[model samples]
Target: MKNEIKGCIKALGKLIFSLDDVLNEAVEFPKEHFQPCANLKTNLKLFAAALQKIDGKYMARKDECRRLMAQEEVALAKCLCHFRAGNFSMDLLQKAVTLAAVYGTRRQAKEMKREAQKIAFQYDLRSQNKNLVTDSKAKWEIMEQLMADIAHNINPADYQPEEQIAWEQILDSFEEKLREKNLDLKGMDYNSEIEELFTSAREAVVPLKLAEKLKEVAVERTKKQKTLLETLERGRE
Candidate 1:
């Protein structure tokens, strides 16, 4: 009877470890590709509830293990919520696959791998339009840097209230000029010189907007950083 009890306890311990591993992998699942749409939210809630049930079942059997497993399950649910909230970008599928490989069931790992491949294909398609991606990426980078500079309070004294107003007017004038020139930044071909010209014009206006918004509390910079980090982390998971 003593040997049988010990064997049962050992089996229960192994089962709890398996559950913990699964919870950890679930917590690290990539959010970008599997964004928590309404369906995902429901699924995650159901999974949490199921985990809680499991904890209850094991409570008397191995209270300490149950407690730890429950905590991990809850953490996994929260991570899913974060992913669904658009906290992470689609780039995190790669990380998800890696994490899944470590602790996921065969089915779960396969699903993750499939998602990673899909994301890679989408990225390849995007890259085929190299000029557009390059230009858009450049514009985004410049905007990001300008926002960061403003956030860091690095603006010059010349970028005061009056100067900011004047700068806005200047931007308005520039917009009118582009209109007169029959140039629409959004409609131009990325590979065209016209598009390059428009890009330059837009870049010229970045500093003015930075100056204007510098005095105000802008969370845009931090939000972008958070979004990017979440996206990358999701992919790496």
Candidate 2:
């Protein structure tokens, strides 16, 4: 029983460590990039507390540990949805607000909605400017769609391979435009951080199977994104 408890503690410790890494990255992001809910830190704290509750009798505290771990995972995923290279759309922010309502205060949820509306208004004004390049407009619209799809947890497997391939071409074209402008998708770096998060989660004992599925999704997303960037250099020439 003592050994089992030690194993559980070790696994939870790894998960907590990964969550800390991604949350720290989120904190360093610019305000315009994404707004992480303040409650994420609180969620992390509660999970950590559960870890501390472990003793020689693992069964006694097992349920509580499982519950906290599940809650933390949901909160972390919700926070991650808000992260994008540029400003998020009102739709995406509203979705985030809904997801956050499960763990955040009513006041915080209302504030998020207000922020979303303000940003949406600003985007509308920006779209009306005659000086903005056509490419910039197209890129913004496509990225917004992509981010929204991710926020909605759209399964890549749900689409046919041909459809997926076509989307990849679209992304390649988008990345090429960014290359011409000497800009890169900054959110690609966040995907790497998310990949690391799943790597840690996969090590935990309680939700090992679920973690594997999540990691597979994260890994595939990162892989597709990196592939596009890799081809951009040669394709541009």
Q: Global lDDT of each model?
A: 0.42, 0.39
Encode model 2's per-residue lDDT on 1-237: one tens digit a residue: 445445545545554445443333221222332333333223223322322322112323343233333333333343333333233544455555664443333554466667656766766623544322222333344443443223223232122122121223334454445566576444233344333432343233225564456557657755864554444333434
Q: How many steric overlaps does candidate 1 have?
A: 9
TM-score of each: 0.29, 0.28
The most accurate candidate by lDDT is: 1
Task: Report the Cα lDDT for candidate 2.
Answer: 0.39
Best candidate per TM-score, number?
A: 1
lDDT of 1 by residue, 1-237 (tens): 344435444543564457664554342333343454433224334433434443444454432223333333433333333334322333344445654554455676687678556645655633544312222332233223332332133221111223222223333444466678785444234344544554455456557566566535346544643554454345434
Q: In order, what is each prediction's RMSD in angstroms?
A: 16.0, 18.3
